[model samples]
Target: MELQQLRYVVAVAETSNFTRAAERCQVVQSALSHQIASLERELGARLFERTSRRVWLTPAGEAFLPAARECLEAADRARAEVAAASGEVRGRLAVGAIPTVAAVDLPVVLKEFRRRHPRVHITLTSAGSDDLTEQVRKGGVDVAFLGLPTRVEPRAVQSRRLARGELVAVVSPDHHLTDAEMDLRSLQGEPFVDFRAGHAGRAQSDEAFAAAGVRRDVAFEVSSADFMADLVRQGLGVGMLPAAYAPRFHDLRIIRLRDAPERVEYLVWGAHPSPAATAFLELVDHGTGQARDRPDPDGPAG
Candidate 1:
């Protein structure tokens, strides 16, 4: 019924130990236990199942957990907004990016962001686009640089197109595909090195081949672009990688797929993002100092 009670329940659910939850809440074990009991009594349902060695959430507790966290997060965001209104940009900004995209000049953007908002703490995470999108949806990440056609549910996040480039076929110098521009169907019989299924770029590659009505033999499924490029360099198989990454592999030949789809990047965030996230978005929108000084859609200039 009360915020404190909700906090206790969430802490217990997270720690799975009442004593540890109480310690995290900075309260005595008895007080925390009493509050949880009072809450269950008020709700007329047991929230947790307890045994000597472990604690687990009941069905009711599982259902209540998300709402409890949301309520706490909203409260924190309200405070963060007031801080932002005071022009004090001091909070953590959790940013996620796919490793392939990170290989691009993302460091430049991050440098500029840090230079302008030095007081804001930045945490960067590298993962596949699917994982990054999911992190953004669950509020684990404030914003993410993701490959386009994001796997995250549309309603849970919004995306702005950042950049678009082509996916090039990377082959060893001796490989036959290196000789000329070719159709994706030409690679159908070749052993290929590809991004793992469900990867952001893999979706594009898969769709391209499927649309062409040809099936390729994927000999290696890799998680990182660099590793995939290495495999191609060793003549293990051809790889489809972002064009921007072509320069990274000196031994490999980068060839354009006559009909391959272009790879796109998006800046994705939740519907209601933190102030630090909004500021980053603004910085991305207006890269120049003069342009950044211009007013945004919401109100006066930031």
Candidate 2:
């Protein structure tokens, strides 16, 4: 029988009167009675005994009442769960970030986002910019924070520049060059704690040095910005780092180099982002620059 028929049976069972049951159900008594009669006919069992003075339940009606009530309750719960899933803004979001950006920027943004949207689950992964870009392109992450000079062109993925940060040279406080801003050429023979070759920061560092006609003596290669900073602190060599991240270390001396290039960090995604991803992007937009640049899909960059 139909769900409404079971509802009518339950209403009548609860009220013990056809007229009151119909009123509770917002239907006429005759209509409610007809539906109950139809249900009884389908089941081939009489659900109610009628007397001149009152109406009473049959043995079958007693047995069916609990099951009918359970069915209605289950249906209600199913509807509620579906609505919660779709409308309450709950889901998992996977985000990737380059080591430097993750170290300096992501913590504040993620903390505020969690405060505002407590139901959304988040997973974070830190990698070099090149690796993070591929993760976004291949759908391993819903969104990513990356620096410029993307390994794969922007056309294959969507990206927006979030912040323009100046790159600076980080050195131990006791180093000779730590006291003053130096020219890019002055770093030619200085020992350097370099980022691994494939990192975007390393690429930018290499480009700036080559353009300025400076050749660096590599002292060590490390994959993490934190590790590079620690190495610099131990007097291994001067390392290049973003200004925002440089302030985090108290022992390191941060100095700006003349004609040093600025780096742009981007929020990259594959195609359109999901709802939760879009919300997180909005938070990023408010924190940094607006998302104005839409990469041209079939252009030379792809």
Candidate 3:
């Protein structure tokens, strides 16, 4: 039956008078009586026994009263929850980021976000740039920090540039070209340590190498920037990494590239984000989300 029908039944049962129940419900007595009669016919049982002086519940009314009251209470709670969600930025937010970007200043931004909206439960996931971009496109994650090789023209989703850096060559401290500024062609015969083939940074490295007409031996491939940096430090091979990420390792020396790919980090989100995600984006737009863009002096800036 309808919610109003249940409400009318409960009110009549509690008041024990049809006129009093109608007054309590702010409806005319005749309308309330007719609705209760319709509910009884639908249930195939009389709900109340009425005499000239007063009214009393039948067995069906007694059985249905408790359940009717419970339904009303549940409806009230559902409405209250929707109202609260509309008014407050409170919920779980799943944010995605690539490893290199994560190490720079993403953590600091999230820290400030949590401080302002304590009710938002933040879950930060680190993945490759391609994977995170796919997740954002599929609506699997609320927002993401994506490293795009080229400038992104927004379409299905929105993007705001949070930071930018140029890709640089990383090598061991004692390597011959550690202190030299060179282009991709200089590493022609050197063993290279690079990210996995499908990764965004790796794709950029491939493009730069192809443009420079250089072919270096990929001696090692790893998914993590830390691992790549360690391999370079151990003299296994040289690595092409973002300038913002190259400083994470102490034993490695960063060299500016003559033609390095520019990596633009973006704050990307769907067209309509959740309240919590929207609030976090607002903090970023207002210059409070730790907007960081430290370009290396030796490399081209975005």
Candidate 4:
């Protein structure tokens, strides 16, 4: 009913413990519980099923959660819109990226955004490209940076290609097979350390190798770029990474591939973005000169 009641419900649902939820909302346990009880009486259904050990959302609560969240988001967006009308960008900006984000200097970009819009709060998260894409589409993330094979582009979101580069082999200095450049077949016998199966990072290599009819052994499948580099540097297996991203590990050696897979980095956002998101996007456009005039169409790669 009331916005404050919805906020309390959301807080309780997220924490799953009345006391912890009260602490998070900066309210006493008794007050929070009383408010939830009052709401339950008004709705004529229980929102949560509570036990001595844990609390969980009942069916009614599950149905109410989404609408409650949408209401909260709408309220926030209204406030943001009013602020923007006054030429002020004051809202939360959630940015997501892959672990090996190299197309843009994120630190410098975020620093500049903060300097210009001091009122906007920025949060950065790193995940697989597909996950970031979904988060953006679902409104969990305001903006995202993702990399996929050149043959494919992000689908179902507003996106622009920032840069394209080829994948290169990463090896240890002590490895015996030394070459300036080689094809995928040459590394067929070498064990590999790669991103997890189905991940955008791994998909490029997988599709390329499958197209070339090359079968390789993947010894380590990891989520962290640094860990993958560590494994390759120890000669556990060879790794494939974007040419731009591989240079960050100075201790590792980079070998160009004659038939390397190409990757395209993109900036993606939802159809309706917040004012803070709009401000950050304009700054990005000004810096890169890749304005929003040309937006990639929404669909999966053929």
Clashing pairs in 2: none
Better of 2 and 3 by lDDT: 3
Q: Is candidate 3 or candidate 4 better by lDDT?
A: 4
Model 4 per-residue lDDT tens digits across residues 9-70:
99999999999999999999999999999999999999999999999999999999999999
Q: What is the C-alpha RMSD of each candidate to the true structure, in Å?
A: 5.8, 16.8, 15.0, 3.7
Count clashes in each candidate, considering only residues at least 3 apart in sequence or on different chains: 0, 0, 0, 0
Show where candidate 1 strays beyond 4 Å: 1-5, 22-31, 41-44, 102-104, 111-140, 149-156, 172-186, 210-214, 249-253, 288-302
- Superposed Cα deviation of residue 28, candidate 4 (Å): 1.8
Ranking by TM-score: 4, 1, 3, 2
Q: 24-84 in candidate 2: lDDT tens per residue?
A: 9999999999999999999999999987667888999999998898788557545545645
Q: How far off is residue 26 in model 4, in Å? A: 1.1
Considering every candidate listed, which one attains the maximal TM-score? 4
lDDT of 4: 0.87
Candidate 1 at residue 19, lDDT? 96
Candidate 2 global CA lDDT score = 0.76
TM-scores for every predicted model? 0.76, 0.65, 0.66, 0.92
The TM-score of candidate 3 is 0.66
Q: lDDT of candidate 1 vs native?
A: 0.78
